[model samples]
Target: MHTHHQLIAEKSVIDTIVLSLPFILIITIYLTAVFISNKKYQRWPFYRIIFFIVGILCTAAALIGPIAESAHTNFQAHMVMHLLLGMLGPLLISLSAPMTLVLRNLSIKHARMLSKLLKSAYVQFICHPITAAILNIGGLWVLYTTDLFSMMHSSILVYTVVHLHIILAGYVFTISMIYIDPTPHRTSFYLRACILVIAMAGHNILSKWIYANPPAGVGKADAELGGMMMYYAGDAIDLVIVVILCYQFFKGNSYWTKKAHSLS
Candidate 1:
């Protein structure tokens, strides 16, 4: 017979697997599509596959493991989850170039339809750097400032919604700021850089505010640690974005300069 502790551990493992099933399924589908596309066409970059796997793992770590379980009672744990789910996970996923893969996989008709939808006013508006920054940073402000943080722990539905919003908002913000894939709505590099700086400031300011005024139920010590994590960890991730944006901008400019010289 299994020992009591062993049985409880097995049950916990089963529960975690059940909770993570949807994410696993989504990852599986994405890999399947990539595999099919690569077999039919040119090979996909190995780096993209690594990025997608790491991104999904980061999300899974935040959502289904000890970190997630501890987050309900520990403010620090929750903040770590926020960093993983909102910043690092999105950055990696966006870098994976999922949209490019999807476009490549689709038939011409479907690709054209998708292209049209991408250029639609609604998509254009939401994908704008300004709009994306507002939703991403604004959502964080609301969650940390209001009682939403405390409430999320109590309601599964609310928790799920908030997590989904964080991931999507982060993805939108990253993609808007950095051209990982073809963007129907393009803003100048300077404009996106300015917006990115402002968003970073907003995020850091909110972390400091949290440090001073802990959320409804969070303790001062835990809040301070969480705040530090948010400020530093967030900056680390944002730094990668900045570097990538600058690299792409300079590279594109150089390419055009060469073309212009050749024409001359």
Candidate 2:
């Protein structure tokens, strides 16, 4: 289903260095902040350092890797990028506990300011499960299904905006599922699980749609491979989140049960 022309087009590089630069800067900045947070507050742990590094790599790869850059040329490629930035990046960063580290590093006043920012209406709205679901999966449906995919390469500004959305959406989605920082609005396991199911369905359906209809310049076969990648990768990352949420729930429940039994 993929003509040689289409396959080649899917592999073109508009400017790899242009794209790679900002992501590298971001990774550098976050890593530096992680170090500063540790030195300032003595909160550095080995596992967390690894997580921060991995999260940086995931985002950097999505923006700079040849495969990823090629994917940007066609609808399917962009979808693949979304999975890396919007799903994998956030999940890894969330696990690293960036929010907690930031809190630890700040003075009481500054930490209080951060808490207030977190509780701001914008944060509240973005981190809400439904809103995060919309930003994560809903964003894909918008890009691949319409003329937006074609528009991506035409404007550098548009390209930058879309990529930022992917990263931010991922953070929102991840923070909603776990408690790394404090959340003013928390959901029950049943509620979060229900939302996850719907989110996964959105992803699967979009992948299948791409398989059926490759966007401009994307071959059907490549679309299938990309779509399958999106489908499988999403499920795998989400499974990790589900395991974490369930583990936390059980851990909390067990602690409360022990305390109750002791009192009784």
Candidate 3:
């Protein structure tokens, strides 16, 4: 078993690259962008230090920690890692309101670029709530139902692609459902909320499905336990999103209410 596990760990060069690249790049790119924006606007935030620390911790847990090492040998561990990377981490980072920070920090020109990016067709298609739901939840369905999950540790390309999906899907999903950033491509509050409900329900149901119908290579008991973990843990992170959205909605309503009273 030790030899077998060790052999499993001895992944291809591509796998090594894939495993490290996103972890490296996302932090690098995001920090760089944040720094540039901050410098431009003279916005120095101490909270940013905390964001980097926790963000890296979450990413490392999913990628380089003992949890990641065990993912090849244990299906439950892999599921947990997926939740950390693709669900919790993205959701938390989104709550950090990084995009807003950037917008507040950037010059008008850069803010306009950011807005334009949000409105672009590529962004519109990928960042739409429905599309994010498909990518985030549907990707899980594919990974388990197909051989993708089992094969991830073997090939770097597969692992890389899968990791990329996790991050992007998480990112797109967060941005689509929540209003942390200034979006030029705005969906109606009702529409976004309705989609959020459907997507959240779908995610919870997928966990149950995984429990009942264990994916290949994973035992039914393990899958069930893992699925349970996903159901509760995902919601804990999601509640913050719910709170933020409601706050934004209520704040907007209050502004309108005050305006109406003033006009009266």
Candidate 4:
């Protein structure tokens, strides 16, 4: 019994270390890119570095430690993890402009290749606001409304895949809405705004659905609390994205008008 307990403790430690490595690696790579880019070009923005680190920390906080463990059984905790992994982390990290930093750091030939990739039809399609919204918000609807949520807890592969999808989908959805990096395939502001509204409605509707119909294993009380958090907290983070998108639109319109007037 003592040996079995010791084995369990060792496995727990291993699990934590494994979980920590990705965030550590992300930070290290980002800082390295910042350092190289600052030397090659003008200094990379200090605030961007801070934003990247804090974003990564937010994701780490959700995936590791007590919150991650509790999420398996407690719906409220799971909701918190979802908010961190999907919405807040992605927004902050996108604001860091990691792709811009990478472009500055890469060789001219490699940079062009990356640019070409970005301009590809496949990239443009998947990065479309509508497509990203479906993947992010619609994916959540499928997960909560189906047996997928319960399966995620039972299977490690399912859990990892679901978490990865949440993060990637969120990041893509955010970058689609707000252009923080160089997007060769840019959509009109009005179009993106329309898509954003639709996506927001989908997300809100999903939260209310979760409130009324709990997932397979989650209890009623937990579902209620989780649903409320999902509704309100999701809005708060999304509001930041809306504000940024509006500012970008305003600046873009001002630029075109000024150029037009100068030509006249």
Each candidate structure's TM-score, on Cα atoms with residue i matched to residue i, is 0.96, 0.85, 0.81, 0.95
Model 4, span 96-194: residue lDDT tens: 999999899889999999999999999999999989999999899889999999999999999999999999999999999999999999999999999
**Model 2 lDDT, residue 201, Cα:** 90
Candidate 1 lDDT over 69-148, as tens digits, reads 99988999998999999999999999999999999999999999999999999999999999999999999999999989
Model 3 misplaced stretches (Cα beyond 4 Å) = 1-45, 101-114
The whole-model lDDT of each prediction reads 0.94, 0.80, 0.78, 0.94
79-164: candidate 2 lDDT, tens digit per residue: 66777788888888888887787677678999999898988999878888999999888988897788877787788898889888
Colliding pairs, model 3: 14-156, 15-156
At residue 24, give the lDDT of candidate 3. Answer: 76
Ranking by TM-score: 1, 4, 2, 3
RMSD in order of candidates: 1.3, 5.6, 4.5, 1.8
Stronger candidate by TM-score (1 vs 3)? 1
Q: What is the Cα-based lDDT of residue 25 in candidate 4?
A: 100
Steric clash pairs (candidate 1) = none
lDDT for model 1:
0.94
